[model samples]
Target: MATEHGIPKLRIVEPSFDSPLTSVIIDLEKLRDNRLDSKTHPGIFFQIKHIFQLLESLGSARIEGNNTTIAELVEKEISGSRNDDEIIGDDEINEIRNAERAMDFIESRIKNNSKIDQAFILNLHKIVVE
Candidate 1:
């Protein structure tokens, strides 16, 4: 891979299945399968998914230097926006919102069996930027 400025971008390949990292992958997969197979109520599962989406948004924004806390995210979500005196910037909030929306968009794509490729990625990017 290469950067937009034409610099080569180093890609990290996954560890071989025989490596110690493979055990982590196996454990995670088993945990995921167990969660999916559990007899949780639909509403409870929905809430779990919602919470995870928030965390996903939080982590994504943090990578870009967004300092919004999970508590603030919940408050902003409840109020639909923040006041002028709020410490967080509008752009930061928007980034978090975009990340959350992107996750939803991906979920929908997967549900609809949409092709996952460059176009799909670009579409997600367009959704996030817009």
Candidate 2:
């Protein structure tokens, strides 16, 4: 494979059924480089940025608001502990619905042998969590 933009070559190892599954250590730096060009692609950016922003905001919120607001938000975001009527805004509710729809779509695609990757999962996570 050819390297692009200082990107390292991808190392794909195919294992035989006779052999035990071998370790395939991934180089995160290479992975990052491979995906860098997708930042401009809205589909990829939507999910990646959502996670990145959520994490960044949570970090910032802790520094600024400390445990009070940040903790509550984190709990509400992760679990269904929060009262839906109060905590879930209009947009957030829509996001949840959209996430479910996207997941279903992905399942269907994979069933039909037309599947997506990180972009799909990222979008789903972003929708539900962010």
Candidate 3:
């Protein structure tokens, strides 16, 4: 740590060359590669992946205090239909839809072998934000 012009600057810690965590990282990578081979079972993998994306979208909405449920989200996603009895707001529904579309874009890019660079991320962010 150092001070410059009466402002304290924190020291940055550099990572070590080797550590016990390296083995864990390697094992996790192997597991990920083995299990995430969508080519092996494209149909089931995409279905499960879509479910996970929906759950992730739901979690994001919940973090923002949106009370939209998975069932409601799926119903809206499937048919764009909303029940008159349900009092969910348009903002909540839109947030869920935005996340779903963002995830879909990412999936599409991956399927198309598109590079996940800064430009790609910015494009995805644009889709999600607007």
TM-score of each: 0.67, 0.27, 0.61
What are the per-residue Cα lDDT tens digits for candidate 1 across 1-130? 5685675666876899899898988888888656346688989999998888889889988998889998878888788565423434578787887777788899999989999877998989986775
How do the residues 1-130 of candidate 3 rate in per-residue lDDT, one tens digit apiece?
5798886876755546487667777778888667443465878887887788879989987998989988778878678464433435587887776777888888889989999876998998886666
What digit string (tens of lDDT, one per residue) describes model 2 on residues 1-130? 6886877677777876555453232344456457344427788777776555555545543554334343455566688754433534544333433444455556667778764665766765664455
Question: Which candidate's lDDT is highest?
Answer: 1
Clashing pairs in 2: none
Off by over 4 Å in 3: 1-20, 32-45, 78-89
Clashing pairs in 3: none
RMSD of each: 5.4, 15.1, 6.8
Q: Which ranges in model 1 have alpha carbons more than 4 Å from their true place?
A: 1-35, 80-89
Give the CA lDDT, 0 to 100, for residue 42 in model 3: 78
Report the alpha-carbon TM-score of model 3 versus the true structure: 0.61
Q: Report the Cα lDDT for residue 28, model 3.
A: 82
CA lDDT of every candidate: 0.81, 0.53, 0.77
Candidate order by lDDT, decreasing, is: 1, 3, 2
